[model samples]
Target: MSTVGKRGASSPRELTRIKDRLSFIYLERCVVHREDNAITATDADGITHIPSATIGTLLLGPGTKVTHQAMSVLGETGAGVIWVGERGVRFYAGGRGLTRSSALVEAQAMAWANRRTRLKVARDMYRMRFPGDDPSGRTRQELLSMEGRRLKECYRRESARTGVPWRRREYSPDDFTAGDAPNQAITAAAQCMYGIAHSVVAALGCSPGLGFIHSGHERSFVLDIADLYKTDVAIPVAFDTVAESEIDVATRTRRNLRDRINSTRLLDRCVNDIKELLDHTEDDDLNDQVLLETDGDIRLDSGRNYGDELSW
Candidate 1:
């Protein structure tokens, strides 16, 4: 008795690439249902149709009710589905990745497995965040020290630029309302960035837990990726939003961040940066192949029995 029974899930080639899709769509107080390939959100205003493949991340905020058929279409189209708190400042859960290939994940694991490569990748991350500063030959502790200084400098600079009053960064994870306007906006922006980064990381088939600089958390890599753009995108957007008006700071910050992300093509940059960081050269047709591991670091096509070729 499902509408989705008639249509098969979309092939990788059929779905829009993650980089080409919209940054994210935040929905609330609506009933989401499937209509053909698109998902429809019906609220008091009216029913709005959104093409499933066009979304990079679908943030279902508090009071959003999504149907099974809607989820099916979203999954088929490779859209990242996230459940979040009001105004999307808190994350509750996330859906699966888009990619069927293991190439990028394999490369990530290969890089993470070794100490030298992991350190190099960590330094590279810092280098990306701190342009004009060579992180080369720096120890992890030195990199951390540099990052701390740069972060403080970023806060000071943004405060001066936007004229938003800033003390130290203070956040209470248990209570969102505990922070001031600027702090609240910064937290909201950071949460949004995490969702966005998680979407890209998942789409690329990389392990979210395996991180270069951060460790032990399930979303360690997601945090690492999100921080790469925090100073450049989130912090500025948050400060600017607060400077304009303190009212509805989180909502305004989300809107401004979305616009900035789209205009700056952050999604495309995010994808490219991940590939570059992992030192991966992904084939265009990686999604099309199902490969099996063979002896001596080779791959064989999957789905055929190899027992006949292997003599007992």
Candidate 2:
């Protein structure tokens, strides 16, 4: 249910869905200027002219075009599909029926997990810094303990808000298959966590696979964040979706589930919560302060907020 833009040797323009023109996806190098009558794309020596009527979703690679008629055709069909790639517009007509509920659930769980993981990391850091000093260690320990308590309280609140019962049992590390009665809310929670972990890894400049609290393995950072999001964003969204859709475990499919998860408002709320938490938090002292604290001579754009740009 997500479109991923691959980073290649030849840098292509990032793809974006057009606002105020939901059917239209604009392609630009620096800024949007032109609209196409028809787009011709040649990849691997094969030329393809994407007709407007046939395309449900457009995926544009760098430097591509299509006609206005095509845009009009896309608008006529209310099929929600993603336009991906740089400027060369490809189409993903399938998977429109994919559900997002599971994704949302996963994202929420991840967020909660991450919150816990970060606190654990901070606690470990505090202990490492003051092993024998009981006074400072005790104070920090109390604070860490409070953070954990708050996180649990938040988890309960979020679960109540979502109307989904929290799964207290630990998932087996070996299990990967979807279970009967899939927890769509947890899936969404996990996705959110993955996003947050990526953000933290980027900000902290650490190998995402290497972690302080989460194990050092594939997608360990993602695991960490999934733990965090459960209490903060996922639960609320799950509750809202359930109320709005009036659907229960018996009727929810992957497609409707995806719809619930991809609800723009829900995503925004989740992002906002994560951003708010991060904005208020001070950088950990043990983090590479030399890299994070250095004020360099390198010129950079001043108006941009790094948090605002993070999306997966």
Candidate 3:
């Protein structure tokens, strides 16, 4: 009983294997749990395993595996995992000194600037595409303009509330391993931003690797879109949560904040916004079939599809 797509087929042997190894993990709000770890999934069924090593700040979904080798493989694939729930997952990897407070501030500031730029671009595109239309078009254009303004205002207010000065400068792309505490925080915040970007690209049916702004990487587009959301969404959420709690920047509380960023309703709101943007796009093509890891079978509306039907 695996999810597949129409015109797709599942392999009987693979399906069985996946089903035997089936395990489900759930993370809601910043809490992670094994929903059904003991359940045996066959080869065809997909089971996501989170490495115990990265549990504090990160949570992987059911289709992933916990092994170091698996993680390396995933990173190589350029396909990132997303936590679909309210809180985005956060984790510190490789003992990199934590992100600096200033770095976090810088990241947020940059995010605000990026969001403003993108909104203006989007509005301009709309105006150029629908020139000389009726009042409806004009009204739509006004709404778009207003949305940009509102987002900018929100960024300003949030920055003030977080007590982080709005530094008007470009953020240097330093390695995560070199980040101090504040830098680590920035990285965590960026991870949430990336999640939003990934979701938007997914909804748009565009390759996250292929980006409009960011280039030369897997899911570069996602990275670009995520850059827009960090200041408006992820930054504010992370900053406010930390500030309100009066959590010590050096303590476990900061980690707690990072892990649970997705739990905030703000993250969910961003996801919804991404979905809406994608809905308005012209392309309607998407592959919704769920692949069964247990038996290498796919579930579609009509019936199970086998793996042999796949192109590769």
Candidate 4:
């Protein structure tokens, strides 16, 4: 008997909420294929089954083959699928989001379209990242300067805590191994955090390019979201990972970071933070529905033809 077919595609109401799903699932050197509603990863050891709906992001690392059916199930469940290099250090592509409502993305665009609103959102983001340090009335340049100083302090603090040698942040795009062990761990942790942020952004149907603070890049908003946890989560985790063992710093950082994110329930926090930042509330009327704009900012129900003779 063939085990190919299952229930029909999941409706928006049937999809899992982004906050409830796992932060991410990483697989490498394996073949991924669908079995019923679940996906199976086959490797030299054995086959492991994973429920598609539980995954927030599926990170396909190096040496992975995904069958069409696997992708199909993943899409149906609204999981973000990202292709990355070893240990998810390099990003290449990402899958679409699971949300059927355009409320969040629309709110994001509206906020981003205004200069003052954009700056306000940026300040709010900084405030969220560093609570007790008010960003109110701070110029953008001042915010950047403050962020740089805070980061330097974070690196120093983590280094002192973990007994890892403190050094200025350094990275080489051409080579991943050029950095010291702590630097490698930090870079790896940063990349993994980016993947998690991208997953949350995609799952919530938010635009990755409409960034408030960071800009001019496809994943600008992604960077902004990821940076929120850098000082507290990523930096600390990187130092701890390197301190624990210098061997395989990148891979170790990914594992430790994943655990920390899950333990901290960062995905739930991320979804909530994005919603709060965008000032978005889910509208049941807009879920899985499309509307057309009229001349006076009226919303017309879709699927009905307005006669051409109707004037604006």
Candidate 5:
């Protein structure tokens, strides 16, 4: 039996070809095995096939057993593989690089390496956050302070809107169980956003660690990208989840966030946002400056940009 039915002769001939793209996926207490280009997920409810090419991120939560073959299929489709703890706590992730062109990555590195350009990028980031505002000559510290004040106000407003108790954002890296309901929900939602952000960054050929606003972390760029949507997406979802008197706040928040992500088409927005910030244009071309070798080392093409359309 085929996982997907064909519509006509011109329809996708390969089962691995995903017809519809999903924003994200979260699975727990299931077994995932690869059959051709699809992943068969089995649990108490029975088995269902997931097309690897269609998913933005596959969150392998607790009790999810996956085979090496499934991973191979997922990688070949340029999807993301994320491992999370029970209840949607992200542990780590891997993703297929969205583009072979190093144009975006090179631009990002160049901007981050220069102080003047980095500050300009930071200003652009702030401008992105406040679309109508002018960030000219705004110091980095001023931006940080402004961001903090805006966040507190955002949390207060959301809590008021959702009738959830307002409190400070708190989470400990060593202990996930220490926060209150809203706090835990926020953490879970943040993790989900991080997973999606990681996939976007990877797909765009951007460095996840090269962050302008934040630095010194493995997922610095992921954090930066995710931060742009946190106030509107994750924070609102967390507050609403807590206000609903749910038994599992984290789970509910994840669901709500996923819904919001889909409804808002967040992954698409993320890709566009990254490209805009990098100043990518229709005439732009990425050089084959970075090529992944069999040994996983990236090599340059004698310092020439690759002449190809940006696929991501």
Candidate 6:
């Protein structure tokens, strides 16, 4: 059995139910304003009520207009808000997230900022994408090359499986019209994955630039996480979209991706995967900078006692 959430009832179960029902809320060419604890959108069609609390994410696509009040409410309620471009819902910018802890963020940063530890975490990431396989003795580069080869073979298999023409990965952000059907579908699928991935990363309070396998960009972490499911999620969706030969690849890709993400429980999986990669036990704390959250603040986890506070 499932439950539906009202305006003020967005418990964990209710939120999961919402994702099960409406994967995400896509807003475009509308003015969004606050309505009580919810939000309303007015467009050429009509007014519609949005239970922001129940939503997993609010993607602000092209032509979307949001008022300050609405933004404030969404932030306060901890909704994932993403600003996307017209081309395949490219994630351009983002707003506040729903993460309740800075401890996770600190842990991620410490893991990524270190050298030896970063390699360990990166190996764990590759291991996550390919479970039941032993890559324990292999280095990061070897694992990367292996994953690349697997992906190349996957594309070939999918091309034959779906009968969609597959040449190579071609993309140009400035010109989306230049790409062919498969290319367009690929971009559409990747962007959709990125949007969803961005929400999960943000919701975990993880920095999008601090990446294990990627570096030197603001969205490095986002790309790194999104790539983990590219072969399984985006590749299949893109190929299927191309096989359908849909005139609107983005729309069809979004539809398929929503269903896939929901079915896979990608949001929750992303959170757990991140923690698994960076998580350490009592024996292996990094840099002596271990941290924890107590009542919403990040503090050193070292078991040291500072005597009772005295007047300074």
TM-scores vs. true structure, each candidate: 0.96, 0.34, 0.39, 0.94, 0.83, 0.82
lDDT (C-alpha, whole model) for all candidates: 0.91, 0.36, 0.39, 0.88, 0.77, 0.74
lDDT of 4 by residue, 231-307 (tens): 99999999999899999898888889889988999988888898889887554322787898888877888898888
Tens digit per residue, CA lDDT, model 5, 126-225: 8877666688888999899888888898889998898888778889876777888889989999999898888778766789999988899988988999
Off by over 4 Å in 6: 1-23, 280-312
User: What is the per-residue lDDT of model 1 for residues 1-312, given as tens digits with 9 covering 90 to 100?
Assistant: 546778766778887888988999899999999998899999999999999989999999999999998998888888999999977888899998788888889899999999999999999999999987999999999999999999899999999998999998989888888999989999999999999999999998899999999999999999999999989999999999999999999889999999999999999999999999998866542376788776677788889888868532
Model 5 TM-score (2 dp):
0.83
Model 2, which residues run further than 4 Å from truth?
1-9, 12-148, 162-184, 191-206, 242-312
> How many pairs in model 2 have backbone atoms within 3 A of each other, for residues 3 or more apart or on separate chains, i.e. clashes?
74
What TM-score does model 2 achieve against the real structure? 0.34
lDDT of 6 at 232: 80
Q: Against the true structure, candidate 4 has what lDDT?
A: 0.88
Evaluation by TM-score, superior candidate among 1 and 4: 1
Give the alpha carbon lDDT tens digit for every residue of 138-255 in model 2: 4445755755765566546765765655654232223322322224434433433343334333222333453434565654644544454444344455445544553443123323
**Per-residue C-alpha lDDT of model 6 across residues 1-312, encoded as one tens digit per residue:** 121222342333333322233446777899999887689999999999997776777888888899887886677566778888885446778887665446667788899879988888878877877775677878878987888888888889999999887887788988876888888888888887787777777766779889888899998888888888888888898888778875888778778787888888877666667767779322221122435344445354656764563223
Number of the candidate with higher TM-score, 3 or 4: 4
Q: Which candidate is the best by lDDT?
A: 1
Query: How many clashes in each structure?
Result: 0, 74, 80, 0, 4, 0
Lowest lDDT 10-residue stretch of candidate 5 = 10-19
Give the distance in Å from residue 31's predicted Cα in candidate 1 to where it truly belongs: 1.2
- Point out where model 4 deviates above 4 Å: 1-7, 283-286, 308-312
